[model samples]
Target: MKAVVIEQFVSNFEDLKPRDAPLPSSKKSSDIQIKVTHASLTHVDMLYAQGLHQNNKRHVKPPFVLGTEFAGIVISSPSNKFAPGDRVFGGGLGSYAESICVDEGIVRRVPGLWSNAEACAVGVSGAVSYGSLISVARLKRGETVLVLGASGGLGVMAIQIAKAVGAKVIALVGDKEKSRIMKELGADEAVSYRQRNWEEEVRALTDDGEGVHVVYDAIGAIESALKCLRYRGRIVIVGFAARGGKMEEVRANRILLKSAMVHGYRYGEDGRRDPRRTEEVWSGFLNLVEAGGIRPIIFQGNYMGLESIPRAFGDLKMHKVWGRAVLRINEDVEATKEAARL
Candidate 1:
């Protein structure tokens, strides 16, 4: 099988290459093998290739596949709950391959409403957005919520999820175009963070200029988002897309003054530690999708053969696209079979 293998730590994306590798072996009765139809790229994938993640420094040596999420058809199932042709969506490391073997505990059956592309894009972003707003943030109806970095995959989902939870959502983007996109995704108002006094604009849009009750900061621009929070508000740190490495310095007096709480969220860790909680969050997200309350935003990439994957990574780093960028693998696999056939 053809796969994108990270053979070395490359400073440039183009240095990564596609290589022919053996297909993964099927697991015993406790595991299942999926024919990967689509795999999507995230910033974390780039970081992993560059040896930025903690494990990459020690483990993740040469000749390892690199990817975290994919949607596919079941070729073989060891459990009674799944059949050979069942469509499923799930997440796993080293998914940039033709097939993957995963524990049945981590995979979820898609609900026949989404496409393989949508399912692949929704993996970590959808779960994190839904879980942070509905669970960690404990967002209340009629409350105001702010989504930082509202144009990215997780940010876009956060905007929609906050609205689905009955909160007045304020999406913070970097420019007017992204602001418009956020508004279309159900944000009550969108603010451009590039503009001066954007924090004041966020405050003005909420009730009585008191700021928002919950702030979802995926950009890691925590100081600005923190300053825009209301008294006794909660801030959910989803990711550090904007600022990486080293913690930001936040004043303790400010936390004391506002009586605010800061929470760090890592959906992957949570899912690995507590599978039931992960399933519950996924159920809620799918229910909202089925109810027409939220929709996945996808950015399509050209269908390239398995050998062209290194270029896809380059395109991602160049900011040549937006939303979720997916690669079609296994031309024999139907694009609709993974998510739409559920």
Candidate 2:
């Protein structure tokens, strides 16, 4: 099997190299074996390659697989929940190869409505968006919700999910183009934070300038997201997409004045600490997809073979790609269907 292996942390994507390795063996009873069809690159993957994420760098060592989300078909599994040739998608390790092994507990069946690429795109961003809105944020019907970084993968999903839950969504992006995309994804209003007066614009957009009921801050810049929140508003920090600087100063008096809540979420931590609850959330995400409440925005890129993993990581680092970047790993049944249609 061909895999992309990172021997050491390097700033350039060229540091990652493609190497041939033996195919992964399947577990006979306890684990499920998937013939990987597509694996999507994420911002966190770039950070992991750059040795930025503290947890990813600590747990994942060199000569390890890079991809975190994938969609494929079951080749073999002892669990009755899946069987030979069952289509499924979820998050796991070593997904940049032709096959991957995952525990039966974390994987879920992909909805028939989605393509292989769409399925591959859903697990990480979709789960985070839905979990943050429905689980962590506890968004209420008719409440106003703000989605920072609303054009990225998680942001796009958050826009749709917030609307699905009956919240009026105000999307914030870096540019007008992304703002347009956010509106297309179901945001009631899209604001670009690039403008100097954008925060004031956000204040004016909501009713009585009361601030939004919930702000999903995917961009980790603390001050921008915080400043936009209204009194009693809650901000859920999911990722730091922009301004990877040290945490800036936030006035405690502001928190006291608004009586707002600041919360941070790590999807992997939440999944590990409460596997059953995580599984439930994952199921809800799939249900949303099935019901057409959410859809994956796939930005098509070069369909490189296994050898191009390093360059793919490089593109990710340079922010050259948008939405989900999927690499096809194998000619599984679903992939075959997609290819035939194409």
Candidate 3:
């Protein structure tokens, strides 16, 4: 099998290269063997490659697979949750190759309405958004939410999830184009942070400029978003897209005056802490996708094969990716269907 491997942490993404590797097989009866069709390269993947990821579940020191989330056809399943022909998608190791072995508990079935690429794109983003907003943040129905960096995968998921539960969403992005896309995703209003007085603009969008009930701060915009919160509103710090999550100072009086709640959320770490709850959230999110309640946006510009990892990584690091990016790990997902029919 051909797989993407990183021998050592390097400053350059081009340092990652494809190598002919031995095929992987399931070591446990509860494991799933999948023939991978598509995989997603997240911003976290970029951060991990650069050794910027601080709270990663695993250290990933060197000589490991370079990718995680994947959509694939099951080759074997020893549990009742899936069968050999089930089309599934989820996050796990060994997805940078044609075949992968993962614990059955981590993978989930793909919705009939979604393509394998879309399934691959949603695993991390959907898990993170739904987990942070619903499970961790406990956002209630009819609440107003401001989703920072609303154009990226996590941000887009946050917008859709907020809308599904009847919450009004004010989407924030770094540019006008993302703002447009956010509006198309059912955001009540979308604004670019680059625009002057954007935080005030966000406030003006609310009734009496009282700010939103909840601020889903995935871009680490803690300080500015503080001004965009209503009294006693909650803010969940979900992502660190700014400055590699460097510690920044915040006015204690702002949070004090508003009587707001501030919390940090990392989906993977949360899952590690509580697997059963994470599974339930993942299942519910896929159900939302099946019912036409949410749409996972994929980046058309960065959709490429495994051969394009370098280019895609470069684009991600430079903040050129506008939405979720996917890599088609295999060209023959339809071929898996043919086998299923037989």
Candidate 4:
């Protein structure tokens, strides 16, 4: 088999390389062998590659295949839920390879409306957006919501998800073009955080100028998020992707005064701890995708195969990708199966 291998913990994304690897076979009765067609190539994959993510670092370590989200055809299944040739998508370890064996519980059939790339495009990020918006915030129809870092994968997904529920969305980005993209993606208003009064602008855009009902914050700008939230508003902290370790303080008094709720969400972690909730969140996200409430914003150049995976990491780190990036591991996958003799 062939894969993108991280041979050691490194400071550079260039350390990732295409290499020969042993094929993975099913070890458990619940596992299924998948012929990988596409895999997610995102900042998180970069983090995993460099051993920056704690759990991925602990489990994957060095000399490991690098990937989580993937879409593929089933080469074999131990259970009746999926048969050979069924198209499935989900998160799994070592999915960067031409093929991988994963527990069937982690994967689900791709909806008929979506393509292989489109199905995996939303994989982990879409679930996180769903958990943050619906599970944590309990966002309601007609409510006003604000999404920070609205140009990234999670933010773009958040914008569409908020709009799907009939909520007016205010998307916050770092530049004018990102703001324009957010508006095109269905955000009712877009604000540039580069502006001096961006928080105030967010407040002004909401109904009656009081504040927004929910804040889906992906950039970890906790201070600014607190400023624009309405009385009794909920703030769902998605991540600290802004690259700063030091964050502005959150005043307990502010929360007390406004009756605010601050939630720190990590969908991946939550799913690990609670399988049922994980199932619910993933299914709900796929249903929404099938219903056309949202779609993956994939780019062709970013879908370069395993050979250019190192470039994928570079593209993400350099901030060159607009939305979630998906890499086609083996578009024709038949060659992969032939090589593996599965």
Which candidate has the top score in TM-score?
3
Candidate 4 C-alpha lDDT tens digits along 193-214:
8789788888998879999999
- Indicate whether candidate 1 or candidate 4 has the larger lDDT: 4
Of 1 and 2, which scores higher on lDDT? 1
Which residue pairs in model 3 clash with each other?
none
Report the backbone clash tally of model 4.
0
Over all chains combined, what TM-score does candidate 2 have? 0.90
C-alpha lDDT score of every prediction, in listed order: 0.79, 0.77, 0.81, 0.81
Tens-digit per-residue lDDT, 1-342, candidate 1 = 777788777787777666778888755566889888888777777777887765576666666788888888889888698998777878777788888888877788766777777777776688898889888989988999998878777887888888887889998876676677778778899888878989999999988999899999987877887789999999999887655333578777888888999888888789879878888898888888889887878776784566566777777666555567777786457644534656
Clashes per model (N, Cα, C within 3 A): 0, 2, 0, 0
Local lDDT at 332 for model 3: 82
lDDT of 2 by residue, 1-342 (tens): 677666676687766665786777765467888888888877767776676665554688775677778888888887688977778888877787778888877687877787777888766788888888888889999999888877777887888888888999998876667677777778889887768878778878888886788899887755666677887788898988654423457777777777888888888888889887787788887778778898888767776667676767666556555567777777456756456556
| Model 3, runs deviating above 4 Å | 25-29, 56-58, 245-251, 338-342
Range of the 10 consecutive residues with the lowest summed lDDT in candidate 2: 241-250
In model 2, how many backbone clashes occur? 2
Lowest summed lDDT window (length 10), candidate 1: 331-340
Residue 102 miss distance in model 4 (angstroms): 1.6
Clashing pairs in 1: none
